[model samples]
Target chain A: MDFAAIIGNLDLYLQGLWVTVQLVALALVIGLALAVPLALAASARRVWVNFLPHAFIYCFRGTPLLVQIYLIYYGLGQFAAVRESFLWPVLSEAYWCALISFALNTAAYTGEIIRGAMAQTPAGEIEAARACGMSPAMTYRRVILPSAFRRALPAYGNEVIFMLHGSALAGIITIVDLFGAARIVNSRHFVPFESYITAGFFYLCMTFLIVWAFKFIERHWHAHLKPLRG
Target chain B: MHKLIITAFTAVLLAGGAAQAKEWTKIRIGVEGAYPPFSSMTEDGELQGFDIDIAHALCAQINAECTLVPQDWDGIIPALLARKYDAIIASMSITEERKKKVNFTNKYYQTPARFARRKGSGIEVSAADLKGRKVGVQRATIHDGFLTEVFGDEVEVVRYGSQDEAYLDAVSGRLDLLMADSVALMDGFLNTEQGGDWEFVGPPYTDVKYFGEGAGIAVRKRDNDLREQLNAAIDAIRANGVYRQINEKYFDFDIYGN
Candidate 1:
């Protein structure tokens, strides 16, 4: 009923928007870095090479993201050893704890996505690279990884959005992300509908931006597969 | 087949239970079992504390059989409004905002707000000392409202969804300070084993504008007769020395602030 409350408190939402963007961006970048190695091991032929990544992926992806966040944020803090550790400074802060959870969670999901894409890479293409005297690692580096990445992009986009949505949970541990801003607004103003609808609108806007960016990248990468114009 | 039949039988029982009885012989009082000294559940699953004892004493005075329904702090008010219980014996502060939805009996008990921190933390209560310090408070509480209205962005105020969560963070050294009802701080945290290192600091915040007229029993606005009965019972207990017995069981000083 009161759209004015949202407009008046736009600064709070915008500040929270910046916090959300920073969290998601950092998590996605770090997650991708971790995911590459994880996917490589997961796609490996040796049982030992794949075992850890398999377990990590299952452990993260099988459980709820909220529980994972709590385990790191509150559960780890429960131990006196963790509290006294050098990492306590960073671990004690909600921002870093949330960052670590989001990154690891996204890495597990993204690792699986890339592993699936790597498996779907054409055997003929890998065979051609090997026949050209490329080493196994070079074949993977040159042909498999590049094609698999292109294949993984769309699914990776979904992971990015999922990570963004997961950032909402950061507020529980006291990081005021976008949804946290809505909660603060609601608590202060007692206007749930107006507060949440504004937050929803902001999320919708960001979702559109992510979709557009991914679409542009997809078109650019898939250009070679397009039929010749002239 | 047995499971389906049992489910139908339970549904019929629940439907029958939903209809309110005209007689006030049996009453349900909602309470938050998490708050210690006021109302907390023992390991044996029995509710005990000042609030529970007072509820029992009041029920005796009115000749009604009362049941204490354990509810979470956040849902306590909404559940009272939903007719899930006849009254909330929870330590609910009577504020103008809540007065719209539910009628509150005369104050059963009142306590001032206080700041608590780790012993020898050496922080004073002034805004200058607390600048950039992380102060933990329960979300949507009078203390939280006070912090926001007074401190605003001057200090880093961390609001949690529960007092237990805030206490956890406090024990972990994540919070520089905590604010809550003085009695809550004493029994819920300070007197507990986990809070051995914590101590109350600064003067008590007894601002009525924010803290309101203290904790009172909350009933539905339509329950005027119930509300009046509760008011009379509160007075009767205070008059007949029953209130003192309950107070002495938990607190040393008078919680019924002048």
Candidate 2:
């Protein structure tokens, strides 16, 4: 019942929360940007166009994100060439290494989610776009992408929460995210329950907010499917 | 500080060992099979190393049939308190902070902390020189606290889950410098081919406030009888040359800090 640990280490937790927010927010945004093109290529008819994206998704989704983070953070620096390369500056920092791995890992998962949504795009809707003189690029940009994004929204929300949880791994690489803060507290005070319970509570609060926000977005997006009000 | 008091009281409940004097036999020892040259798992799950040999020797000296229980480093203490094992021989330090929760036998071995870096890196241990440098240390260890207390934010502290992970970062150039037990660094990294270009930097840090009195066998706080038996066995072995035999099996030098 020594919940006072949370109050005493409040500043440390806040600093950790700030880092977690930055890492997850930046990773999700970058992942969303990469996923769009990845899904498009993955869904293409030509094997050459789809091959690279398919492989990228499989490699990432197939392996654990923790291993991917380890490889990027600790693996990349082992190479003499990597150290000599211009990218060394970014690769040398744990923050950047964590960010890069998280971005890439999320992109693979998000790409598959969007690709599944796109595959279900009605043939009639696509035909209507084509009949209206919409070019293929224009059709994807204006209709296909928009429709797929709305359909993928719920799944993407889940991915966002998963990313939030996954960012805890940043602590292993030395980035003091929320989990890291709790770990520090636990190690220092030897109060594993109090420290971790505080962290779990924070995460629970965040997950709830994300769910509520997503529910609002779904309501607005599914307005057309709702019963008409007199 | 308040949490420290709370931890002190709760430690009583966690390690609630029966205060009765019991005959010592068939004891289970907690060992972390992850630290190399001390205790590590072979490809086939057989455990071997200095700590393993020492544990065996101690058991023989005390005439106790012992079983080695493999445990992760992070949870070793909690596991000990939970009565999962009667004692820990995992190269755990005898420190004031740890004294709050567990009792320790006399130190079986001692080593000082040292920093290592690129051969020509020219990194000094001073706060001014270490400013902005990334120093890697195993998280939740004595070295981590020492580094933070010494330099505060002057150095960018990178704490890894294990000492091995820190060495990997040291090899990858992600860390400008590294810190750990001198013996551990020699065994875990300096002896490896990847460590060819790395050299020990800075003087050995032996502040009792941080490094403590060195590695000791830990038992539940109320297990006074077992602690006495372990201490006598340690003394007996050290006098009978059994300690040296085990020490030389792994190290060419005195590992007991004699």
Candidate 3:
């Protein structure tokens, strides 16, 4: 079973796991932050306000993340202006390129999820908030956003896991995330099963933890919506 | 029910056709169309490279209709084993580790590995000198193995999916140095516009322990007859000056190593 190889490369696996976590966590936070505004703009009454955001959502969601990453990492580098620009320092690093691609890609999907949840918000609750003398901003902030977030939690959880898997593509761009480490081991030792199986185990562990955490959050956040027992 | 019976009969006939005995009449050859000077795609999607020419020459010698299948380098071996292609004519080095999984023809060519750094970087290519420096290499290559084995503790090895990626990183200054086949570096990168600022920094390394014998066409283990045929073709091309003709087209020096 080549237990020795797994044990020997444990540090590399952990380092890769650390990179994967950093990529997913940072991207998720940035994506959600960007998504909130995008969702609001997408749901606005003014056609002009929603147009660009809708286009952005469609472009990002429609294209493959791998192409987006390659464009940012290699495509941008092709331009003399990009190379000479102040942004070159960040753009030159594969780590930053991967993070930016992940953030942009996830923002589109999360924006749609939040927009859908906002659309599904009951008209009665919004009316009740307005009836209680709440301002438009207060009604959206206190009632609509909270309700939408709770509803979006389950779907958002899936996006989180999807992003975790998507982060594997970071390896292609030269960032040694979990999949990269496995690839290194596989190439070096020629033990594909042992090398990849160990990485898979780590991914499975991460997935389980994510699922458990989301379940815990869902239980508390959606307590009011839970069915009653006799 | 009548239509289902007809469909079943057609399926059986197709299966019977596929199970027929192998004639070396038609052979599918896999090539990584990304590696330039050896194998690369033109702007109009034509595969043009020294390796492609060599594959054609070999196919002609054996009187077979050859088909070139472009595949990503990482999955090239597995694709061969799965019968996605009958053989790999990519610039795949003949190594002991690879020999365990697939059989390789006699080497078509060999070249030493070399390291390159920016013209004014002043970074010496050595294990001690490269401490903590980021060195770029194409993943799943002999150079990657050599770098990791020798300088792994002293330097950070950044593995890219393709040689071009490593070249890009090196030119962008993200990588302190890049290691790859000497001829490939010269033809594909160092002689190009973006790579104009880079130059080889160390003596060419050709230790057989890591670099292996040379680049060879790889076929599945069960394809011994095909392997023998390819080896004979390689010898025929080399003897008849055809190998030198292709070599002169791509490289000035003899790429066939001692």
lDDT string for model 3 (B179-246, tens) is 89988899899999989999999899989999899999999887787898899999998999998999
lDDT of each: 0.89, 0.89, 0.90
Model 1 lDDT per residue over B26-119, tens place: 8899988877778888999999988899999999988889988998765567677677899999888888867866889989989999999899
Q: Give the candidate order by descending TM-score.
A: 2, 3, 1
| The candidate that achieves the highest lDDT relative to the unseen native structure | 3
Per-residue lDDT of A4-65 in model 3, one digit per residue for the tens?
Answer: 76788889899999999999999999999999999999999999999999999999999999
What is candidate 1's CAPRI-style docking category based on DockQ? acceptable
DockQ of each: 0.35, 0.62, 0.42
What lDDT does model 2 reach? Answer: 0.89
Question: What TM-score do all the candidates reach, one by one?
Answer: 0.87, 0.91, 0.88
lDDT of 2 at A149: 86
The 10-residue segment with the lowest total lDDT in model 2 chain A? A185-194
* Candidate 1 vs candidate 3, lDDT winner: 3
Candidate 3 i-RMS: 2.1
List, residue by residue over A1-230, the lDDT tens digit for candidate 1.
77876888899999999999999999999999999999999988999999999999999999999999999999999999999999999999999999999999999999999999999998999889988999998998989999999999999999999898888999888888898888877665556677888999999999999999999999999998789999
In model 2, what is the error at residue A89, expressed in angstroms? 1.7
